[model samples]
Target: MSPSLLAALLYAALTLLLLMTIAALRATLVITRQRTADAFTPAGDDVSPFSGRLCRAHANCCENLPVFGVLVVTAALSGHADITDPTALWVVAARVGQTVTHLGSGRRRAIRLRFLFMLVQIALLTTWAARLLWGAMQ
Candidate 1:
């Protein structure tokens, strides 16, 4: 198969992986929320990880995944995979960073690293999209 086709398939696979991660995160948040709500007391604080802006965080992450996926797919479909290596590497690195953050030590540190990785991933994807658009216009 052609390089472009392979790149497209890889991007699609990454998108699916993102979807699956979102689903799992949602489920975990739901359980956490339910437990917190059920255990609420008159004098005690419901210190649930799911209570403070986690839904928004998850939503934001989900939003970016599709944007990245679309850009990568479009570039690959437009015969731009040769130029897509940098973006693909960025995506892969971001994924690895995310996994490490999720499974590594230091919650605060992990959170910051994950956010940075996501930002880098978004930037890479946006750059790829802009390049593809410029090429199309040429």
Candidate 2:
């Protein structure tokens, strides 16, 4: 696989890891009788605050992952991996930053940082898309 493809897989794996973490957290809570497990919805009165953070973080990743995956996969498939590879690395960095920031705090500064990270990802993906489209137009 090309670097872009590898990065895309790593991105998906990391997102999967985030989701599985929430599942494990819920499972542990249910096992300990800390909370009862529920399907589909993330927020619940029975869940702990720490678990709530995990849930929300997982939800955030879930919302963002599809677009990122699509763009990266398109780049790899369309033979524009060379242009996308660096962008993918930067996006991965920003995505991790966003997740970590979200986990740490929801304060003004943290929210700003999270937004910045998200913007970085959006810009990187947009760049990748533009480059791919531009190349295809040739």
Best by lDDT: 2
lDDT of 1 by residue, 1-138 (tens): 544345556555655664565456545756867443345332222433442233334344455657655766677677787667645765766755664464453478778987887777767777777888899999
Q: What are the per-residue Cα lDDT tens digits for candidate 2 across 1-138?
A: 666777778778878898788778767877888665654355632455555666777777778778877877787777677888766777888888988888788689998999999999888888877887888899
lDDT of 2: 0.77
Q: What is the lDDT, from 0 to 100, of the residue 113 in candidate 1?
A: 85
For TM-score, the strongest prediction is 2
Q: Per-prediction TM-score, please?
A: 0.55, 0.86
Report, for every candidate in turn, its global Cα lDDT versus the true structure.
Answer: 0.59, 0.77
Q: What is the clash count for each candidate, in the order shown?
A: 0, 0
Name the lDDT value of residue 3 in candidate 2. 66
lDDT of predicted model 1: 0.59
Question: Which residues of candidate 2, in runs, are more than 4 Å off?
Answer: 39-41, 44-46
